[model samples]
Target: MYTKKNYTIKRMLSWTRRYIFMFILLSTIPVVLYEVLDWKWLHLPWLPIGLVGTALAFIIGFKNNASYGRLWEARKIYGGIVNASRLLATMVNDFITNEYALKDRTDAEFFEIKKSMIMRHVAWMTALRHTLRVKKPWETTTNNKSDQEVMKKLHIQEYAFTLEEELKDYLSKEEKQAVLSKTNKQTAVLNLQSKAIKELKLDGLIDDFRHVEFKNMIGELFTLQGKAERIKNFPYPRQFATLNLFFAWIFVALLPFGLMSEFEKIGETLNGSNHTGILFQFISENFVWLTIPFSVVISWIFFTMERIGDVSENPFEGIANDVPITTISRGIEIDIREMIGDDKNEIPKPHPEYEHTQM
Candidate 1:
């Protein structure tokens, strides 16, 4: 999500502001203490810190892999839902065609209804997509007006109000409550669509084979919807992730002290201002500021990987680089509408500004 080269440092600093402070504070304590005591030997501990880096690497590697698995699994479930929706809708259209052959309506009337159902299926795809993304279904005024007309054509007047105020007022409290209920509102819409097919069967609008096929398609859609919800709800475990992360920072923080003994011995044994002093300096260079940088730089890599893994583990959250669920759902809706032979020129296009640079 943040591939912009110029903003990379800014984004990283923002993500790890607290950790950056801790790393500095933790590293600075030793340096300040050494200066206070005037003990040059204290600097040798940092060499031991270098050992923790190796163990920290393995911990971060394991956690990053676990996080990627969650991200990848969420994406796969979404892809499955898209394919299932398409396949189910296609089956409905095919079945409806067979049912139409045995219907009493005129050929032209049958043709119109067939086209209508196909187009309506496309609208369902769009609705499902928006629901998953938690976006308002009515993005444009034109879309609302179009959907109103669509409902009217389909004779689903209960769902075609010009405004919320247009809803019925002549009702008891319970009746008003029924109108306000979320489950009833959605079920009403689904029932209308499903009822149309049921009526078609009764009126010989479609044959038994076609009706059965359409019912099967809807069943599959129901199954796929459940599957998507399951994947989103049941996330990966947090305990293993938390344990691994704690150990990584702990290892890096404590590693320098153990390597201090060797350097202190070298400093004590070697003569001052002798050939051995130059020899000691040569080895000491690898154990001083040089080693600190080595340790911090190594920790930075693990920290960066850990941060990336954290973002990916929750696919539904608005983190950068998660599944583009909103985009995918919108595209599916538009495609389904086109397939159903609805408004050819009014197909919705994906927003260019969906991906924000200022997250």
Candidate 2:
């Protein structure tokens, strides 16, 4: 979804702002209380705290790695979608021929069949892409070739707009973005469009040559769909995540106790001077602040990274770097309409800004 190779840096900074604030707040609270109380911690050893910190660090590392795996899986699925969509487009150009165009089916029927089937396929691609990305549907226009002949023949000017309006309500941003990563939406659109091919085969519009070609394309589309479904429904095992986080938490919570001994020894050497005591008070006052809050920050950073990774790998879910399913679907609609001779420029043009921004 993020076309830029290093785009995750920006994404991390933006999404983690709230976590940073919360972690800091949690840390600062303890520091302030200890400084005010001027309390002395008589006898705890710091060894335990060091052990906890090291253990938690390892657990956090595992969590980050696992989360990344899920995200990468989503990326691979979208790669398939991109290939499948291009293949379908190519097949559309391959299968339809002059043989069917010059058949016993009347001039009107011939044009109607060709036009209807092609445009629908285009719509199918758009719909599938959008569905994966969960984007709104749009009017079926073939680029900017708006002409009266194309519109009246296809009946798209009126009908397409309605579909667009309906789609506007149905597509949610998160779903659209997440789906884009796996290229799942495009696969779905292809499934629906498969019916058209089946109907054509039944009606004797498409001959054996065209039928075979279309069948192969359909298989690829379905394959893409299955792969996406697997990734979405079965993200990496949760058991590992739970254990790692639990252990990491326990380790982080106890880290400061080890460090505390050193801090207290320094205080004793200072001979409890009111001024030195004031400083010790300041430092020790926030033991929880230094250890617990710091651990929380470290924990939050790891968790937040995992969360962002979860959303990004899917890309069709409309997270910051998610693929824009709505836009792609609309583009497919535009292309298919034109390929089938439905050139109503009335269909919306792809936005350059949005082009790069889609999941």
Candidate 3:
């Protein structure tokens, strides 16, 4: 997600330049036809266009609100994951102990077990993020040329490496193969975690109570993962998205025509006034031409609002404004590794930001 407080005007304009040009073209055509070609009859009524604008405003507002809800929910789910991961690390360190062991292992052996469980949890997170990053049919943000350009500008860690490559560092060859063989790799990893905790219980590293607690924690992680998947799998309603776009464009197309007549009337009034200065008179005589910029600005606002909802609808799509799952996952890994006293050199660093955007 964008780390800065706001996007620079230059970047915003650059991202929407093509659409701005289209808005200008859409605005200019009606003005040219009405004023230059004497097609005065082509102008639309102000009341009808105003009603459309009002309705369009409500539609855009609703869509943006819904999209923001989805984005925030996804972020919250990851926030839960972060907390659960840290808790798991704490539990692994404190719960698994020689106090109840049938056969005690050395401190180094215990540390290795803790490290293995923690690293496997990290691998689970890696798999989850990779699964979310996989493009869905409804996720068309990357398909746009302008959006593709924006994506290239940011450094998305998930795109830089494959899940298999990342898993190598955290999982044993056997465990990695087992997890990778499943269609739902994250689920497989979590199942492995559950089995390990059960074995610890059976082997007396942890008692029945601690084992139950571990199971509950694993269940919570599974719940969080399911929430994230729900948002990723089921998109904002397509009918709403499609109709919103159509209505916004329809209003944009008719706006210039409606403004033409109103501006012309103002110009006529200026020309008829006896006390007006030359500048006012000149402006009045050519006031209808001002419709071009006004129309462009108004249309740009609607288009930009619509675009915001579109991008926000899928927060996992690796767009510049999306939730930074990759960064968050890496952070969880770092925090938990530190919790277990793993060597700093062994723990991977946090993912880097690019152009003030993290993904």
- Quick one: best TM-score, which candidate? 3
Candidate 2's C-alpha runs over 4 A off are 1-14, 25-39, 42-51, 100-115, 122-192, 202-205, 244-252, 255-300, 309-315, 331-344, 351-359
TM-scores of the candidates in the order shown:
0.65, 0.61, 0.96
Please give the ranking of all candidate structures by TM-score, highest first, separated by commas: 3, 1, 2
Superior by TM-score: candidate 1 or candidate 3: 3
lDDT of 2 at 180: 43
Candidate 1: tens digits of C-alpha lDDT, residues 1-359? 76577576775666556666666555555544553455656654444455566666676777778777867777777687678657755654455544354535665665567655554444444334333433222211123332223223332211233212322322234433453465433233344457668877877766888778777766665655665555455555667667657877776576444333443455445434355466676664434333344445555667767766655555554344556665666566666656656566766676443432222
Q: Pick the candidate with the highest lDDT.
A: 3
Q: Candidate 2 or 3, higher TM-score?
A: 3
Query: Against the true structure, candidate 3 has what lDDT?
Result: 0.91
Clashes of each: 7, 34, 0
Q: What is candidate 1's local distance difference test score?
A: 0.53
Can you write out model 2's per-residue Cα lDDT over 114-196, one digit (the tens) per residue? 55555545544444443443322211122212211223333222234443443333334543343344544555445546766
